[model samples]
Target: IPILMGLFAAGGTIYGMAEESLPFYTLLVPVMMAARFDPVVAAATVLLGAGIGTLGSTINPFATVIAANAAGIPFTDGILLRLAILAIGWLICVAYVMRYARKVRADQSQSIVYDQYESNKKHFLGDHDETQTLAFTTTRKVILGIFAAAFAVMIYGVSSLGWWMAEISAVFLGAAIIIGLIARMSEEEITTSFIDGARDLLGVALIIGIARGIVVIMDKGMITDTILNSAEGMVTGLSSFVFINVMYWLEVLLSFLVPSSSGLAVLTMPIMAPLADFANVGRELVVTAYQSASGVVNLVTPTSGVVMGGLAIARVPYVKWIKWVAPLLGILTIMIMVMLSVGVML
Candidate 1:
């Protein structure tokens, strides 16, 4: 009643939480605080005001619960760890954003840099709007039909041949042919698209490919038996926590092998939890590494279902996607590490 009465008193100045409230809040909070805070402080306060929703979205309870319990930690423990991590990681992320936002603005200021250079400028047929240049040709329809049929056949073929990846290649090959037909593509056009697709996937696919390496990197830190063993001959060995870093790195690397984040947790966390405790480390730490390592690298990897599906849907060449997101993947990886290291998280 008090809140409503106050809002009613303000009338037009007050607004309800509705579909478009987010941008409104972002723009309004600073204005409301104009009397009390300096401009910088007011803007920051407004930005921070929206923090809870962002945190909640990023730190999903379902993922936390799944990771925590599977790793033999309490669910509450997961929440606590997530909150801490969120604070630290997001602080670093935000600082990075603030730092880079200027660079982005600067880059956009000279937006025609690529076009300004003469040699590197590309005018390939399928580069931008292939849909306009390449009509649906007879060959394209046939190839598409063959590609569609391959889906059913590939499933059966996998059961028969015991090669899961054969299906993917078959589909890609069939699609290539279909695309060629529809575009009335010459052999060169067919080859060009295939090459283009492969080219685009370079970095993005590799990022997915390297998830396992990152996980393994953490797992193999100084705290591992191997480190302890090396230390046995030396002075004192490394801290046990260093071993946690090793495990985290190892998990990142192994993520390439597992591919699916939740699936990897199911397979690894059960084993990892006991291993961490046996090694005298915290299970929550391992879970943190596992989640972050899987997440950051997963965003860039081409082999992922989301990635491949997005490419297929967008008609983006794999190489192009790689070129587009490779650096972002690096930035995100650094962010994950920064989040994990600063005691911001569990």
Candidate 2:
């Protein structure tokens, strides 16, 4: 599931796949709970899987491409470096989540959310029948095939055909109808099921709206620009090594205020990219620092609709998520600092 999240996200340019990932929480939370893992595991799988991929974005237009362009470099200028970071970061994230998952599966008492285990199980698995074994009938198999194909087509369309949410939503809607037809469901059943599913995710939708509202408020107040201007002053006249690391941390702070990757890139890269020359580092390194910091912060930023919405859908508490992800966040932070320091010297 983490790998799938990475693949799906790595292909697209939609705010690090934060909104794109909300539906999967509804799908994966129940499965993870049934498999004796906590909702945190499911939430982390999607968030970090996609987060790390975006952090080390190579071809991601919003992150890597836009930052590179604003920095006056080709998007492919540091492609190999970004790919290496993505590969390493993905492995680290998968291992961290797997370790927690295995511990939770081995003993439910070990789950970080063990206190809410019963309630979470009930909330996520209430519709499921534990006693009834599902038959792998041909109809079921075909439905699964269509489900997989929907995602495959979505990925292809986004990567190659420039498809966005409208196009991708149409693909899923069409696939859902086909699946309903294959299952021989009546029109009323289809509509009811669709409405129920949407109702179930309504809270997540609202959280996303509220989060975006906050971004809009910040923009209207010019708070993001103020923060960016302040950051510009702090990085001037530092040594190359110190300069790159400080730039990364500054970007991290800005990512919270401006969670949109493309927005941040356009705002900061133009101002910060040329400063890299004074620091004696490549502008591409500035692009890398900016994107990597944004990627890392988005993993946990409350300002991000993706992070909050995914947790809401997974039924994971925000505080509990912070407790669970802090260690991994620290590790990634150190790794990124080291990578940026190395890039400075290189």
Candidate 3:
């Protein structure tokens, strides 16, 4: 289940769910407790999995699409590079989580959140059955098939038809209805389930909204351009390679203030894209840097509602979460820096 959840969270990263970790965390926390593993393991599986996933987003509308469009480049221009980054990220995240899971499973005291895990077990694990495996029924198999088909349709629609988020969301809505029908849920049950799901995810929505508020404040203050202008002067006269690396780190810093990928694209890409031309760097490289850097920072930035809110749900203190995730984050950053250097050469 941890492995499956990690894969699922990785997919969520592709969709750019930096501030939306609660739903996955909710599903994982209980299972981890029931398995007698640490809650930190559950949190790490979802949080870091999604974090690394976002860093590797190839076709994410929020990150790649907006940044590409802002740079006046075709979104498909950086596909191969982004896919390579994603593949590397996915491998690292899976290995890290698996290694940590083994440690905690063998001895729960090694977990940073061991005390909290013990206290919370009663609340989260009372009804769970660690020994019982789910029996797959005909209806369950049909539901799984529909779920997989929905993803195929989404990929085809986005890659071939250029469908946007609205259309992708519609596909999910249609699939949800079909799944409900196949499960033999009554109309009332469907409605109730939908509400319950939404209610459970209310914190995620609130966090995203609050995070956006920071961007709103910066825009109104008229300091956003000042920061951009300042950044431009600092990068002037650097070699293309150095310039792109600086831009990557710049995006990492700016992402702290503006957690929204689309917002950052709209704010920085216009300025950074034109500047890239003067530095003898490709606009595609600029976009890649923005998406990659911002995605990495999202893992730990306080401005990101996703990180803070996810930690809140997992009962993880901000300091402890940092201590637990920092080593892996550093490794991921070094790997990305190498990839960006390669991208500059390309």
Candidate 4:
């Protein structure tokens, strides 16, 4: 459990790595069930791991670069601060998951899905003999090397080579083919697997579309700016400390209404940036507050495709997720508040 959580936490550190959370949730759910855990643990693991990385994203282009650009600040400014956020957030997530995992492992009745354990085991474990020892063949080792090498290349590409989603996608496609071939999968088998995987995730795609459509409605209604303008007016004459906290919570509230980090950046930065000057807060702090608040909110917001879609895949209801995640979310919120307050002082 520690090793698994640590691996997922590391995955969160890289900028675009957390995008795999939805798919990883699907894969991890069965594995958790097979290991005598509730599927909710798998679902929570996905969001907490990826979401914390995003909340503390120091260098992720999607979360940090666009936000910095929108605020007209140097992208590298406050990087240390962001890294601090990442470190603290990652530790909190690991601790939370570890504590819950220990409880569930000690007593299966403690699991939310205890009633479904028998049926879940039947479905996920199948007829495979648990006692059989499988050999790690030379071919399998080579395949593992290929898999690791692909991600190493991807990390280098993104960190140093200015690669974005398109380049990363191409690399993944190439890696998929190489891995499949090395695993002795036939062409038809590869195609079938891809289709099946996509089919299972089709709802996630649709949910994302629907979430974006909500943004479209707000955009067409022409009320996004009004909300921003009203927010600015309401916060006028606040001191720097109060202003930063208000801005952080305002971003949290807006996250429910906007949800998309980049979209919120484009919408709020122009107003928030200049407002930061009047409020005597650094524009960098404003961007920090925006990204931190939005990223944290994504873990629980119903409007977030990642949140709802992942919950759906895990078969965990939205209310149940909120109940499970609320305590952790509260801890994270307090952490973000401290980070922002400190950012304002610095």
Q: What CA RMSD would you report for each candidate?
A: 15.5, 2.1, 4.4, 3.1
Q: Count clashes in each candidate, considering only residues at least 3 apart in sequence or on different chains.
A: 50, 0, 1, 0
C-alpha lDDT of all candidate models, in order? 0.45, 0.84, 0.78, 0.79
Residue-level lDDT for 81 in candidate 2: 69
Tally clashing residue pairs in candidate 1: 50
TM-score to native of every candidate shown: 0.42, 0.93, 0.77, 0.84
Across 4-51, the per-residue lDDT of candidate 2 in tens digits comes to 656644643333555666667777888888887889888888888788
Superposed by TM-score, candidate 4 places the C-alpha of residue 149 at a distance from the truth, in angstroms, of 5.0
Residue range 140-235, candidate 3, lDDT tens digits: 999989987887787667545867668887987899899999898999999898897677567666765787677788878977767877887888
Per-residue lDDT for 25 in model 3?
Answer: 72
Stretches of model 2 off by over 4 angstroms after superposition = 1-16, 127-131
Query: What is the TM-score of candidate 4?
Result: 0.84
Q: What is the lDDT of residue 70 in candidate 4?
A: 88
lDDT of 2: 0.84
The better-scoring model by lDDT among 2 and 3 is 2
Better of 2 and 4 by TM-score: 2
Clashing residue pairs in candidate 4 are none
Question: Judged by lDDT against the true structure, how good is candidate 4?
Answer: 0.79
